[model samples]
Target: MKRLLTILLLTLCVNLSAQTLRKYSNEFMNIGVDAAALGMSNAVTAFSSDVNSGYWNPAGLVNMEDKQLALMHASYFANIANYDYAAFAMPLDHDSAIGISLIRFAVDDILNTTELIDSEGNINYDRISKFSTADYGVTFSYSRRLPIDGFNYGVNAKVIRRVIGKFANSWGFGLDAGVQFESKNNWKFGLMARDITTTFNAWSIDKEEFAKVQDAVEGQNQELPETTELTIPKLQFGIAKKFIYRHDFSILTEVDLNIRFEQNNDLISTSVASINPAFGFEVGYIDMVYLRGGVGNFQNELQIDNSEKIGFQPSIGIGFKYNCIQVDYAFTDIGDQSVALYSNVFSLKIDFDCFR
Candidate 1:
């Protein structure tokens, strides 16, 4: 049964790779950064206004009061994969800001077993080796406020890199655009168009390294995989409002609609597109301590009894700000309602004003 399963999985992977345009290409970038935003289920599109705004909605960078630096790390898939991120942002004059960010997701020490059995049909443990698979993204972002008060726009130029040990690698490029508007009543609205130019990755494979696998599994992987990959566009729209009372306490609430052109298992699915809605809120005291909670990833999942049920992911987090430094932590998949494993995320942010 184990061998049969392995063969079936290999076939499915090969068939899926035949398509040049993938629905989830470069998906590691979508995992998000900053524990505060992840805890809010990535619903901060409207009010993401720090160094991390370079990844969430660049337009929000204009709200920064000083130069800032951000860093975050998270573990996934039972610690098999490590995700790391860092960013820096500074105001360019009064009306504009610029930032750069880097992200890496990697799985290290993956076993290579194609040569486990030698040509003499002898089992040789020494022939086994280990390699790693990693993906990287670098983004340059610029944001400027418009002549009209409370309006801003931003753009991002992104470069993507992927590596599969010595077997294959690829480079990709893409563009993104974002806009934010604030109303007189303090209502915030934002729109983000990701991969506006459609990202493309061209791979180069090592035929010699791949040849060993072709003969290891007869009739399987006989041909090389596709060399090109395309990532489609996605849109996120958000709105937020903050309610303040008693001078020192406030609550900020936000809602976001994430749209994809292809139909899938999202909550609002159709032939042409699908919409996933996320809702989050933060309670703050004296602008120093905060508590956040959110729910998202709504899906209609198939059950064992041939039935369907609604499943979602929930996250909660806390944050503290002191002088020019901030620290945050989040606990995701609180109830384990979804199929994905739970994760604990942590992040730190510092403002340059402290140095001066």
Candidate 2:
């Protein structure tokens, strides 16, 4: 019986790794909500104070000031909508905080058209098909603060899915680990290691692309394999500082680091195992509103001459709070397109702080 149990456990572990291999690239879902609000600083895992943090940094959950539940939704300009971010914290008997969260991203209504071709010049039109990419994902998180000092820890497991036209569909899983620390009087810091395990499972794939097996790896295309395993890299980190002014105004600046062992087909694969860093600043005023802007070096390092400027991701955002509900929004530029395709984010939050 002991041997049987051990074998089963080993099989489960192998299966998990196999799942990651099936997907081409664990294309993370981050459509509707502004990546800036939480991702401006190299994926914003430290935006831990509100519901958005549940998506960006689940480890922040341990720092919740009160036991509460929150729900938030946001939309982006490219017909993308996200339904996420819910967390309920319950202070355990020993001052330890326990919390759970749900996060998701979705995009839809894309257009696709195909041109018919005469396959053999027989005047017979060839079959044509078309479609757009659609994707969604969900993740669950648990977090808690450590006692005896100012430290925290948390974990999250995510399930992702995506489909495009009639060609492909895939699903995958991801895992995250994070920690946070603060001082008695002045300093605060956070770090989150994301996608410790990331994978994508091939759904329906583009038959056309798959059919022509490339001759050389230099071609930069897919090659048939006995099995395809998606590449999920390691390590993403964040750090921050707070500046106080009087009692109502303050400035918080943050810098984050992200490194990845990218897949062969990933957008960032060319710079595999490279560290991409970012910075953000939040200025608070009137206690009811906030002004924010940020930039990342990766953006500038990746600037394309004709695509867009990459010097920075300058972002502007605002937040409003009244009694028990708070709302936040931000606008960002992806260095793509000169005028039309700039990205934006909208967020709505409800808190029961009145009762905390």
Using lDDT as the measure, the top candidate is 1
Q: What is the lDDT of residue 15 in candidate 1?
A: 29
For 1-356, candidate 2 gives per-residue lDDT tens digits of 22422332332223334334333254444332433364343435554554445556666665556566665555545645434555565545443455555555544443322223243433323333333445556666677767748777777777766655453456667777777777786466667665666544545455553332121112334333322345554565776777879988988777766566643322234544656666777787756777777765444233456553334444566677676666666666655422324555555565565775
Candidate 1 per-residue lDDT over residues 116-227, each given as its tens digit: 8887899888988887779999999999999999999999999999887676788989999999999999999999999988888877777777666566656665567777
In candidate 1, which residue pairs get closer than 3 Å at backbone N, Cα or C atoms, i.e. clash?
Answer: none
lDDT of candidates 1 onward, in order? 0.88, 0.54
lDDT of 2: 0.54
Off by over 4 Å in 1: 1-16
Off by over 4 Å in 2: 1-24, 30-47, 67-107, 110-132, 200-229, 262-272, 300-310, 334-340
Specify the highest-TM-score model's number: 1
